[model samples]
Target: MICDRFYFESIDSLHVKINKLIESVAIIAIKMQNDLRQTSM
Candidate 1:
């Protein structure tokens, strides 16, 4: 029982980290797009 709980906790933490990483990547992408538009204009 203890090992199973630990495994789940680790998975939960990993999921949170992945989510944050994706969020940052998305923000960076949006910034890059805006920069491109400004340069073209």
Candidate 2:
């Protein structure tokens, strides 16, 4: 039982980290797109 709980906790933390990474990547993509548009104009 203790092992199962630890396994789930690890998975949860991994999920959180992945979510944060994706969010940062998305923000960077948006910023790059905006910069390109400004330069093209």
Candidate 3:
């Protein structure tokens, strides 16, 4: 039972980390897109 609980906790932490990483990537992508647009103009 303890092992099962630990496994779930680890999975939850991993999910949170993945969400943060996705958010960071999205922000970087938006910034890059804006830079490209400015350069084109």
Candidate 4:
């Protein structure tokens, strides 16, 4: 039972990390889009 609980905790931590990474990528993408638009103009 302890092992199963630990496994679920680990999975939860991984999910949090993935969410952070995705948010970072999204911010970068938005910045790039803005840069492209400014340059095009």
Candidate 5:
């Protein structure tokens, strides 16, 4: 039972880390789009 709980906890933390990485990637993509528009103008 203890091992199962620990395994679940690890998966939860990994999920959180993936979410953070995705957020940062989204922010970077938006910034790049804005920059592209400015340069095109």
Candidate 6:
């Protein structure tokens, strides 16, 4: 029972970390796109 709980918690933490990474990547992409538009203009 203890082992199962620990395994579940680890999976939960990993999922949270992945979500944060994706969010940051999306923000960076938006910033890069804005920069490209500014340069073109």
The most accurate candidate by TM-score is: 3
Candidate 6 wrongly placed segments (more than 4 Å): none
Give every collision pair in model 1: none
TM-score of 2: 0.96
Residue lDDT tens for model 4, 1-41:
99999999999999999999999999999999999999999
Candidate 1 segments whose C-alpha is farther than 4 A from its true place: none
lDDT of 2 by residue, 1-41 (tens): 99999999999999999999999999999999999999999
lDDT (CA) per prediction: 1.00, 1.00, 1.00, 1.00, 1.00, 1.00
Q: Can you give the TM-score per candidate against the true fold?
A: 0.97, 0.96, 0.98, 0.97, 0.96, 0.96
Instruction: Give the range where candidate 3 is weakest over 10 consecutive residues by summed lDDT.
Output: 1-10
Question: Candidate 4's error at 36, in angstroms?
Answer: 0.3
Instruction: Give the per-residue lDDT of model 1 (tens digit) for 1-41.
Output: 99999999999999999999999999999999999999999
Model 4 poorest 10 in a row by lDDT: 1-10
Candidate 5's C-alpha runs over 4 A off are none
- Score residue 35 of candidate 4 by CA lDDT: 100
**Candidate 5 whole-model C-alpha lDDT, 0 to 1:** 1.00
Provide the clashing-pair count of each candidate structure.
0, 0, 0, 0, 0, 0
Clashing pairs in 3: none
Model 1 RMSD in Å is 0.3
Worst 10 residues of 1 by lDDT: 1-10
Q: What value of lDDT does candidate 3 attain over all alpha carbons?
A: 1.00
